[model samples]
Target: MGDYEIALGASTFIKQAIDLRPDVGIVCGSGLGDIVDLVEDKQVLKYTDIPGFPVCTVSGHGGCFVFGRMGGKNVCVMKGRFHPYEGYSYREVARPIRVMKLLGVKTLIVTNVAGGVDLSFKIGDIMIIEDHVDFASMVGRNPLMGPNDERFGIRFPSMTGAYDKELRAVAHQCADEMGLGDVVRDGVYFYLAGPVYETPATSRILRGLGCGTVSMSTTAEVITARHLGLRVLGLSLVVDLAPVGQADDAVGPTHEEVLSVANSRSLVVAKLIEAVLRRITV
Candidate 1:
């Protein structure tokens, strides 16, 4: 917890410096950092300047925090995220969310790049995560599997309503108003601890389990946010298609490919997020 104290101090310093009393928090993934450009009165803070902050090394991820207004609401946006694959502990990965709670973030909007396993899904499509199956949990690892901090939350928090229902409805309504209803789909997301993409056989098994998309992150953050009593919403950009069966010429999608897809689809995602910001209340 001492390590986390260093991070908390850093967050406090940033909060004071930016005069940021954020009502909402947004976590940007892959090429989705462009949304920060839309913020008004932006104050940017580099992760390195913050105490105990883990800097991002992945390409397309800008390691900075932005504080500003979007759609008439005050918000803080993470232009990049720290992942477990980056050699950070689960607690370290979830540290930012805990700090966000301390900084008064009541709602969290998390976004990520995912591979479409559901045949009905197309590349560049956006899927709203209705629920998640944590493959990490089945493998004896979990973000919450640590010393309980009573100051933050209870020992056992109910995850039955992790994703806020009202917020999701508002997102759908916003999409409908923007004529993007067809592009917005709702489905279960499956998390696999990875720096590597899944194999065809593994993809098939996940698809059979009703997973529409697969990603390496998001679930840990969701759990942390929910434990802190924040209303959570997740949106994923489908960057590649997970085809079933072996092919002699088949090549797996690269991180660059994922970023490319995210870049192209960012326009739609930005619009959806901005619209939701304007329409959602508390």
Candidate 2:
């Protein structure tokens, strides 16, 4: 618990200074930082100033920790995230989840911008992640690859029910009430170790493995949270569609594209998150 102690101490200090003890923690992806704008009476902390917090290097990621009221609930939100592609270890990437747990956050909501592997998906669509295909573990890299911290969780934690089904059902119901029933999708997300976008063959392989969407992050965080007995909810914004080897000159997605698509779909995502917050008893 030494590492966790150092990380948690720093997070707790900041959280206390802000006078915010939230029941919920949210990690916003790529271009989804705008949700912080909806936070009332917000307190913002820069990641660089937080001890043990990894600085975000990706564009469109606003690296800040925000605490405030959303949908009548106090929430702590990470406006950006650490990635393995930025040279951080899996444990380092999972540090924020540990910090959230220490800060008394029982529920975690994670979001990401991804490429649609399912033909039915379109850009600007939102998918509720029911399950994930962790290609990172398949290739021998995992956030839980090191010594297990007994204080944190066991050495072998079951991920069979990583996502909270009840929360997902509530989210869908909220979306339907908001007249977005047709746009909410539910499926498996494929996580790859990528600073680079997928090749045609990689996309095909992921599709064959039943991946609905593909992204470079999320799996590590989910694994860490589930291990710690936290309820989890995941959402993905479809930024681009994976080309099925149709065109060599296909215009692959860029960080800019991800931000644009996420920006366009931010309202719907924000509404769903807000509704979930309103419904949860804390």
TM-scores for candidates 1 onward, in order: 0.96, 0.96
Listed per model in order, the count of residue pairs whose N, CA or C atoms clash below 3 Å is 0, 0
Residue-level lDDT of model 2, residues 88-201, one tens digit each, is: 988888988888888888999999999999989988888999999886776758777867788889888999879999989988988899888888899999997889998878
Give the alpha carbon lDDT tens digit for every residue of 18-125 in model 1: 886889999998999888877899999998888888889888889998999988789999999988998988878888898888888999999999999999999988
| lDDT for position 57 in model 2 | 93
User: lDDT per model, in order?
Assistant: 0.87, 0.87
Give the per-residue Cα lDDT of candidate 1 at 39. Answer: 84
RMSD of each: 1.3, 1.4
Could you say which candidate leads in TM-score?
Answer: 1
